[model samples]
Target: MATQTYDVFQVIADPSRRQMLQLLSEDSLTINALASSFDMSRPAVSKHVKILHSAGFISIQDIGRERYCILNHDGFAEVQEWIDYFDAFWKSKLKKLEALLNEKTGSHKL
Candidate 1:
């Protein structure tokens, strides 16, 4: 069977998945340990974990008999790049507005 692909944003769009990321942020966790934190069934949690893993947000490792989920930076880097672009865009616009306001008010305090 062919592997399925997932968009980073789409994978994180679900609240459960987002929470899973937050939980994993503190430390790596086994699949069962992670599932216990949620109200959903093990299969449901596993499904979300699979999506997160496929989207590059997480990596699963086999430690003896348990599978551990660890946070990965690859997916977050894409989101961060997008946010940084907008941050620069907004800063430029705000600087222009500040300059215009200073010119009109005859003050550069701001």
Candidate 2:
């Protein structure tokens, strides 16, 4: 069997990974610093970081002896674009509904 790969949504489904993103959004942190914030072992934290790295949500930098994790906007662009499409769809639907309601009530206030 082939090893399955996860997409951004699937990778971020884990609570730990979500929290890691939130932290990185505030400021870049070294691997050790990120590991300290979680109850899990350093290796476990590293795994989550790896997923985020692979998904393009975060970038790793080697600073001296430490590896720092920083937030990257490229991954979120996909999610944002998906949401924006639905936002426009809903806005159009709501406007049509409002027009229908106004026509029925014979009121232009709306």
Candidate 3:
């Protein structure tokens, strides 16, 4: 059987996964602790955690007997860069539009 790989967008598309990210954003949590917060079985939550881990969204570390889930910024870098690119793109276009509007209004004479 082939293993399934998910992109950042696809991995974050699920509400449960997004919620898991939100929770981890606040603090690191154990698998059992995270599972208890959701209305799902431990295995089910493990599946989501596994996906998040595989996508670099979360990191799992063993502290004695408990495993902790922590949020990782590396996974979000791509999303952030993409948004920043578009933000800059729109800002440049809007500035050009504003200049054109001011020119038409003769507001630059002052």
Candidate 4:
């Protein structure tokens, strides 16, 4: 079977998946452990985990018999980059507005 691809944003769009990421953020946990925190069935939880894994938000490691899920930075990096671009964009706009306001108000101090 071909490997499934997921968009990082789409994968994180689901509330369940977002919660899973939040839980994993605290520390690594087994699939079962992650599932226990949610009201969904184990299989349902596993499905979200699979999406998270495929989207690069998490890494699953086999420790003996249990599979542990750990948070990964790869997926978040894309989100952060996007946010940073907008952040700079907004800052530039605000600076221009500030300069205009200062010019109108005769206030040279920035």
Score each candidate by Cα lDDT. Answer: 0.91, 0.89, 0.93, 0.89
TM-score of 1: 0.66
Q: Which pairs clash in model 2?
A: none
In candidate 2, what are the lDDT values of residues 30-107, reduced to their tens digit? Answer: 999999999999888988888888888999999889889999888879778889999999999999999999797886
| Clashing residue pairs found in predicted model 4 | none
Model 4 spans with C-alpha error above 4 angstroms: 1-4, 79-110
Q: For this target, which candidate reaches the highest TM-score against the unseen true structure?
A: 3
Clashes of each: 0, 0, 0, 0
Runs in model 3 deviating more than 4 A are 79-110
Error of 1 at 28 (Å): 0.3
Taking the tens digit of each residue's C-alpha lDDT, what string does model 3 give over 1-110? Answer: 34689998899999999999999999999999999999998988999999999999999999989999999888878888999999999999999999998997896565
Query: Pick by lDDT: which candidate is best?
Result: 3
lDDT digits (tens) for residues 3-95 of candidate 1: 677787788789999999999999999999999999999999989998899888999999999889999988778778889999999999999
- The full ranking of all candidates by lDDT, starting with the best, is 3, 1, 4, 2
Candidate 4 has its poorest 10 consecutive residues by lDDT at 1-10
Q: How close is every model to the real structure, measured as TM-score?
A: 0.66, 0.66, 0.69, 0.65
Across 1-110, the per-residue lDDT of candidate 4 in tens digits comes to 44677887788788999898998999999999999999999988988888899888999999999999999988768778889999999999999999999897896554
lDDT of predicted model 2: 0.89
Off by over 4 Å in 1: 1-4, 79-110
lDDT, candidate 1, at 54 = 89
